[model samples]
Target: MSSASLKRLAVAVVAAAGAFALAMPTASATPARDNVKDKAEVIGKGKEKEKTVPVRLLSINDLHGNLEPPTGSSGRIADETGTVVDGVGGAAYLATYVKQYKNKDTVLVAAGDLIGASPLLSAAYHDEPTVEFLDMLGLSTSSAGNHEFDEGYTELKRIMKGGCHPVDGCSPAGKWKGSKFDFIAANVLDKKNKHALAPFYLEKINGEKVAFIGLVTATTPSIVTASGIAGLKFTEEVAAANRTSKFLAKRGVKAQVVLVHEGDQVTPNQSPDACPVVPGLGSRIANGLDAEVDLVISGHSHQAYICKVNDPKGNPRVFTQGSSFGRVLTQIDFQIDKNTGDIVRSSVVADNHVVRRTVTPDAQTVAFIDLWKSRTSAVANKPIGRITADMPNTASASGEVPLGNLIADAQLEGTKTGGNAQIALMNPGGIRAGLTYAGSSAGEGDGVVTYGEAFTVQPFNNLMQVVTLTGAQLKLLLEQQWVGGPNNQAFTKILQPSSNFTYTYSTSAAWGTKVSNIKIDGQPVTDAQTIRVAANNFLVGGGDAFAAFTSGTDLWSGPLDIDAFAAYLGAHSPVAPPVANHITVIP
Candidate 1:
């Protein structure tokens, strides 16, 4: 090991204590300028003393274009004590926090998922408002998350490069200006050219170089709609980041931070800030990182954590994630050596701050959100239907969720009239948010589900497709939920079935035999039986690793999934969360 590696090890040992300090509760909505020290430090008393520059990095992830304060569980985050705090995020609150923490040397960045699956105010304008929000926040750079590819690689380029939407033309807000910040992906490459979309971003702070290497999870292909990401290849996270770090090192840039769009969760009941270890891709990437790589800022699991993970040289390193939906922001402070221009690894300190609504929201951000809301309010505020209670997207042990079932039932009902659909299934991921009976901040009143609310739940606007699949193919589709199934899924992803269709699975059963007792309308489905199934086109294209859907015949396309959901809610006023008994799991 080099002298630098040995020194890092000693510093890491001391940083362990600072890592624990992150768990202490923060004062609600405390201004960053009040708490942070922005000055550089000079160590040693003699002429040998070296000066170091201080840099503050502020990060958030999975904002998902939430211009307004997210509602329900999405709006809350748990403290180290496991106590949940509510009313945490909104564009204004986030802006206030960012502004408070920002200094001349401060860099505001995002891990990924800044948009896509957005609120109607932003999504209606193809997330232009959200991009404008980021630019206004002065975000320096961000990695592209899986959701970034929702519309496809070409659309992502347009989002970063800026132009009027090819399909929607320019929104009422006016001509679209491209993002001011850099959107980079080190791992995602053009298959034909084998070149990254935007490899890495460089920032000069206080006459020192700080490099940010951006990467998305390789599993992106499995999770995202296949066609949207066509011609792009997502490489493994660790390898991509390490390779980029090496490239930067060769160029005399060594103060490196990886902004990766993949992460792991804190252990259950563990304080996100206090956990010493975590399990998942985030931890793996952090631990595997080269000694030259100073820190890892991650997202995707959407858990708030400020933890220390050992790098390859066994030197402790800061690894952190801010919880999703702008509810939390991770603050990382470090010193860069004046002579070496590399991060003082031991000087790294990280903490996760909740975007508490207690603070006065930034007036500019409030006006910005309201302006977009006005542009979309005519259709957004229209009452689509009523809901009896919250239909949360939270899934049961069997992976069946009330909202998922509701969406599947809606798709079945919508397609049955013209397409003659017998069964409907919905992917759990496609159900972004849930139906809440309480009124939104828009003042639509309780039990009234507005067009905006429905759009938030089903923002993909995926077209509904009804197709004929034999019972054998349906069984195969069910089996695909497990690890040994088609495409070798990393984990189980139980498909949500409509009320009329039911199935049972066993946890102990091996592979293809894990599922059985499939039925439609109380009748057993035989292998030779042909069933008409309804689902979004993304599923029919074999997204989420459910390849069986690709074999379906007699395909017929119909209404947008959101339209079906709205129509169903209209037909059944005050709709209730459907019983989550469509799927059963036996031990």
Candidate 2:
């Protein structure tokens, strides 16, 4: 800890907090500007002054198989979009970020979603690249996100141990590597015996005992497909955290924190143009948590915020979460009584830095990503299609995207040839990718969206399904998007229907309202009408945490989403991705 720098920082903190006080509360806050000293708890009886040790933690969540820096999406996401904040998610910039703040005491952590349903860039390389990147960045450990189980426990075990997949031929001369950090899951259970997989992880840092309890939302089984996690069960988060904290205490560790992939429930603030950063589900979890845990870091909801609130147990806990895609990082600093090893008080300081792709990559880290990049370049660079303009895929987990609409359309078009297909539906989770537009690289670039871009847009191998749904049943599916959670508002809006059909939605109405004006092929759908539709099997089997999809009638599995997309791009060759011209909610 540098005393001189701390003094300078202290002075700046006071001056900035004064300025911020003029505005009172704000959506985004800075430590220097917010003057957080007043909010901290004083330790040592305020008699003796000890130098505050600034523990800098750099964190990211939901990496979801991103290996390259900013320009990975046919160099699209690395380039441009209103929703797209540029940052190379690859390990190089991350390594640089870690090194700048890292002393022997620094901690690097992730909330969840670091793998699964990944792109060929990482998946083609068998998620080798992502693991290698994290190892290079020196991640402390991570809580298990749902995607970790996409291939079931077998693959996850292989990833942890062998660091590679059992691909017939990933390399005759190469190796698959595992991550540097341990993966802990406090709550994921095996149903056969109802036992925890990896309970919790604790470490001694700077002579202070810090405990980490990892968990995912209990409803994860419903969010992911039943098949992918058929024999496993996810337990309630708060209960799991409490139990794990007790376990750590028995092991002689006191300071406790929770790393969860679940996020908050927030609507856009009054300023729609500026993304509304508000307390999300993370906030709720913090409020309901046990007193033992001192901090909570959240993801999955994709909103950025920091707050100090009392849990249901009435113990104060500091909570923070940066938005997704490595755009920002939340750093928490605290003081623990040396004798008792209890956190006296803490201040929340955060820095949201973009992963600027054009910046020089850290040599060693860049080499790691490049080695895999060169090996997978053949499929990575293959031209998929051309988009004259951008089809931005920047919506948060709780929102919709224009690219989602386009892909849904493509699924509809490709599946409609048979008598089984009429309307196309998509799960927000399955559409894990986006198409690249022409001018997405740093400055002026190409107008052609390639096949690689389309593949990136539809990364999951979730096959497409044409199912039969009665008009009433379709309405039921829409309603499931928000029900069966701890609350009515626990989820986001359902994927919007294609232009050929339109549905009415009202937040004022309770969940599961009908698609009143439902139209298909210029005809209104009535109760007696049974319509054929295209949806992913995950949705058909009630994925998205939406249970209604479990009832799709007369199911038929067609080509997987990526293959269908390839066909759509081929037919629309040299065509701009159909812009999101239709579909609107009538207020």
Which candidate number has the best TM-score?
Answer: 1
At residue 524, candidate 1 shows an lDDT of 93
Instruction: Give the alpha-carbon lDDT of every model.
Output: 0.81, 0.62
Q: Model 1 over residues 278-347: C-alpha lDDT tens digits?
A: 5877888888988888889999987888888888888888988888889887789999898888999889
Best by lDDT: 1
Residue-level lDDT for 559 in candidate 2: 85
Deviation (Å) of 368 in candidate 2? 1.7
lDDT, residue 9, candidate 1: 32
Off by over 4 Å in 1: 1-50, 276-278, 484-486
